[model samples]
Target: MHRRIIAPGALAAASLLLAIPASAASYSPGAPGIGDPYYPYYGNGGYDVSHYDLRLKYQPTTDELRGTATILARTTQDLSSFDLDFLLDVSEVRVNGIRAAFAHSGQHELVVTPRTPLAKGTPLSVVVRYHGVPSAKTAYGFTTWHRTPDGAVAADEPEAAWWWFPSNDHPSDKATYDVSVAVPDGMQAISNGTLQSTSSRLGWTRYNWRQNKPQATYLATLALGRFDITTSTSEGGVPVVNAYSKNLGDNDGAARASVERTGEIVDWLSGYFGPYPFGSAGGYVPDTTTGYALETQTRVYYSPKQFANGSNTSVVVHELAHQWYGDDVSLKGWKDIWLNEGFARYAQWLWSEHEGEGTTQELADYVYASHPADDAFWTVKPGDPGPDNQFDIAVYDRGALAIQALRNEIGDKAFFTILKGWPEKHAYGNASVADFRRYAEQVSGKPLSALFDTWLFHTSKPAAPAARTASLAAASTTVAQPKSWRTIEATNDVHGH
Candidate 1:
């Protein structure tokens, strides 16, 4: 009888109640990839990692690595399952202190299904126990783990974290790190940030390194070997630690001469790019056959080959400048790599000028004239260079040329203002080429769309400015072609990612 007199409002309420279960079932699996065009599966989706605490032990004899990684993150969406970018074998995985179902989706993706669905905006803790020979592992046709004679070093651009630890694994999702590595006694384990302490026990030694500032996963590094470690302080009390492999042989003196100036170069960089962005500043010269250097956060990774031709502080300047442009303010995607390489290269020109080597204008003119209009170098657009050309020399040289052009277009005042202001605006964050263009426009009060297109996006060489030609002529006549210009050219020949 009461049902016969049911009101329309009560019917609506009953209908709403019936829809609750369906609404509760709205949760879905997070995406497997972060959707970068260059490297589709480079990073994971649905979560943003905040911190990573990795406790690792390595035995060089067996070339085996064992580790436990504790990742602190927050879900960005309702997640029934999520993925982490990892390549090693996983022994166990725990989500929120509970064992979760997991499987390897691909070479780099470790898919995890939590026992309970996770709501968006909730904090998550994941503990993963893993053991593998990172040197033996390969993904996407290469390995970031470089096996050394005494020990191993994990240092590579945009992909090293996947080898040493499970992570979100992209510049867009930066997090602080606490890397504690335990190796055999008499050996050293070097990593990013400040070295907290070292303890010895049971024929094993553990080194604790902490990075307080937000850093891209790729910037987290690990070097385990015999190193001659030196410590100092920079201009602003930033602790400096330089490591040189004891067996660097002929390259030993040169490596030391170059990286030992970490404190001075960092202080010099602070003058142009604002204060040093990290609490620690230094670099490690490891004896690896890979003839490349990487800007691994506060502590850069320098191969012995970097100093094969005398002390190369120009490379040092390039990497340290990355501390401001690439490290402090990272790329939103792999495509914006010019934002990292170009500015770093430009810093080398500034250093050359400061050292009476070569003016920025001279170097820019040399690079512009060296690469003819029909050269293949012009075809690789720096702003959106594909994965293959991501680290190409053009991205660095032309990228710097773009900067010189910007300076010419906007004058020294506006250009320098942008150089100092861009990092401050996007400190400890990720930005895109478009973001830089907009920021430049905002700072200079000029539209930079056409300028960016000509210098960054065009598939041909940008035209030399009339003023640049005149300036180059004057520089040629008045300047004696600074010795640093030749150094810049030589360094660029071997500049590696």
Candidate 2:
């Protein structure tokens, strides 16, 4: 996620002044920035990407990856020039099968000028060829595209897809993918969707993966290494593909057990969150130095640290829940990340309550009481947490608390509607906090402006859900009683770290 400056004269070099065909004169250069508040230059404009065909080859000995990205998109406006988020060294570029002039400009922006004016709604094809070592970068204190011991991982919370391929990297521009990676013989490669085919030829093995469902670029990932692979089917008939590195050694057993519980957990979550959103449901464990686990679309990339210390079921549930909250229903911008992390943390509480290990009420109360009245975590609002605090504990912990507060205020039935209906309503699309507020009010039949303001937007920590729920229930006596209840417990353990 490094902001790249356009190399000296890279964009305006005389060599790139190719003539534009005169058939269509109504065209202008598309704007480079997508206008996101936190990440103004994250995605490109004037085009909608529909599909990507990526062919990659990896050489462990050289620590290098060479690849080609073929993007299929449609123009949103008449455009003579467009941009893709691309880093690394690229050799050739083509637009609609014709050689085109392109350059690296403005920190990861690959500006391409086609020789003709592309009409609005016309299908366009862009191809780029690149080669480099994909190494993790520390941008704004977050690591992305981290190289692991055995293989490498391409993952980031909001935006890092630019590191791997030329793309419309922002979350709002979702696209399906067909990714095929070739590695040395005897090793394995895993990616987003079902494994369509695997073949070997002349000491190289290629794993072809297809993720047909619309996916945000960040959710697209690739992991390669010697792995113990497992495949199963959920009771609901969704395929499950789980893998773990042999490097885990003694911890592999715990990782395998977690995989076994994955199918059952997906079914359990389906009971509450409606059908599983993706075609596949599972996770993969990588021997990565990185500390965190990420819900990478169909497969959550579990770090070695997760199973080595302990495999907390709540943590698993937290990431699995993100497949719905974050992956299926994406964020309109980085500012609205609570729509992703908050709902995942809330799912941890929901899972704990259903399993009788702990109650969501207790979890919420525990998190609310962890900080002093003036703690920084409590002071920052989940919806508007500045860029530095985007992934802070406040975003996850306090976000869950705010959502639990909403559940308490709206009662069980309507809250369930918000949970089940939110994902389905915005299935495979991006949504914002204002969008969520309008949706909640529509489903719950309650004027929730004050509630949303206090819990999600206000700077100060609000009253506990218990006090808020009691007041709400007393105010509206016609509301039905919550289907379940649990007395708050005194435990100090936070549900999901």
Tens digits of per-residue lDDT for model 2 on 1-497?
22222233433342235355576557766667676777666787889999999999988766688999999999999988888877768999999999887877755678888866788898989999999876632333444677767777777656667767889988899999999999999889899998999999999999999998999898898888888898999888889999988788777787677666888888888878889988998888877765567888998877766666555566677788888898899999888989988888777778777977567776665566556557777778888787766777788877887788888888999999889999999999999999999999999999988877887777775654544562322222233222221211111122222
Stretches of candidate 1 off by over 4 Å are: 1-24, 464-482, 493-497
Question: Could you estimate the TM-score for every candidate?
Answer: 0.92, 0.89
Best by TM-score: 1
Task: Give lDDT for model 2.
Answer: 0.77
* Clash numbers, per candidate: 0, 5
Report the C-alpha lDDT of model 1 over 1-497, residue by residue, as the tens digit.
00011112332232222222344486666666677777666677889999999999999998899999999999999877788988899999999999987777656778787888889998999999999999888875678898889999988876788888999887899999999999999999999888889999999999999999999998999999999999999867889999999989999999999999999999898889998889889999888888888889989988888888898889899999999999999999888989999999999999989997778987877777767678999999999888778878899888998899889888899999999999999999999999999989998998888888988999986654642532433222333455777677666644454
- The CA lDDT of each predicted structure is 0.84, 0.77
Global fold similarity of model 1 (TM-score): 0.92
In model 1, the Cα lDDT at residue 138 comes to 85
